[model samples]
Target: MSRRIIACEVFKPYLDKLLEESGVEAVDYLEIRQHDHPELLARSIQSIIDETKDVDEILLFYGLCGNAILPLVSKGIPIKVLRVHDCAAALMGSNAAYRKRFEGNPHKRYHCLSYGERDDEYFARTSPEYRKISEEYGEDNADYVFSMLYDKFSTPVTYIKLGLDGEESQIRRKEEGYYSVIEGDLGLLRRMLKGDDDHVCVTLHPHEKFVGIYDYEEILTTVNRNHDREKTREE
Candidate 1:
């Protein structure tokens, strides 16, 4: 069956490499800026899905993503979503793997290639909330607010290397403060692309909606329309 991929732009570089190697095209990348508002992110994805035609299936390169994927509903075409909390977990290959590393270390920030490339200003500039704060409260207050919201935790950053050549040097050079590097496995993504529905993906069939369980294991599931209707009738 013909397939298309809807992925976050943050994964573009890595997905580009994978698509090139696999010779699979037909992918759409959405802006990372939408991540500032999960609701908007979900709407943007639904818009893309609404516009998609001729594709038998859509492969989403995303995680629960602050529940952004939770509202997505499949119509005629089925959607396969990566089963993880976010891109960081996807890079680590699984939710369990990510939890093993950082479950207890909640203060540590996880950095990847895309995250490493952007500076603090880039994030602040991209965030609409930050812009509003800056406009209303002034730049200094905005900085303080964001720093309190995002930079309160003090710990060495953990950089995940996705096995790309020259990535280590680039990340090491850009990352400030103490940091550690760990090899990231793309095996889960490879499996997803290969259509191996073993455990790394949750497939939403036509009329089914995605649901986030808010846990490390069983990260997401699909709610069938029939089941929802039954529940509504019972209620």
Candidate 2:
């Protein structure tokens, strides 16, 4: 069977053009908009739900709304929310609530597609012609390619360890393997810690291997130890 799908968009006409060009036989489109501020994405989704009541599935390309939007969209529609984005790419996904506004067509099946994944599949389909990128820039260049593709979807990772060598060393440090007067990347670790504590303080020596296994507990302990050590020397 051909892919029967009713697609939703804040702008309906735009969606129509896309369908014709792409040759998607089973797609329905809806237009959503708000004059006040585009940031109020919830309103757009509300429109979809009101306009569309009997959908089998919805395909949305918007924010990854995390856990926030699911409750509202599911309240009115029984169909599954189909979210799509590019492969680890710039276009991640939209909140599900925005999806609720669309009218569901029982004839359509639900699925999500991201250009990012399709792009990968496209290159893979191209084969040796696609392999030219790897031949020219090397495999490591794939990160740059992914980075470009995921630009819409990517965000900065919060808990980053600056200089850890390997996993074995990390597990050892967690197991108290650095038992005695040990040197480690204390200063860098301290910078990484979030909470302010009075109990622990840790010193980092430049020569020591940095361990990344330290969770919130280890992070706090390191901070507290270093805090006291500073005071002891002052006294």
The weakest ten consecutive residues by lDDT in model 1 span 117-126
TM-score, candidate number 1: 0.88
lDDT of 2 by residue, 115-180 (tens): 212333433424453467667887667545644443333222111122224323433432252112
Clashes of each: 0, 36
CA error at residue 73 for candidate 1, angstroms: 1.4
Residue 48 of model 2: what lDDT?
57
In candidate 1, stretches whose alpha carbon ends up further than 4 angstroms from where it belongs are: 120-136, 175-177
Clash pairs for candidate 1: none
Query: Model 2 lDDT vs. the true structure?
Result: 0.30
Instruction: Please identify model 2 stretches exceeding 4 Å from their true place.
Output: 1-39, 65-71, 79-235
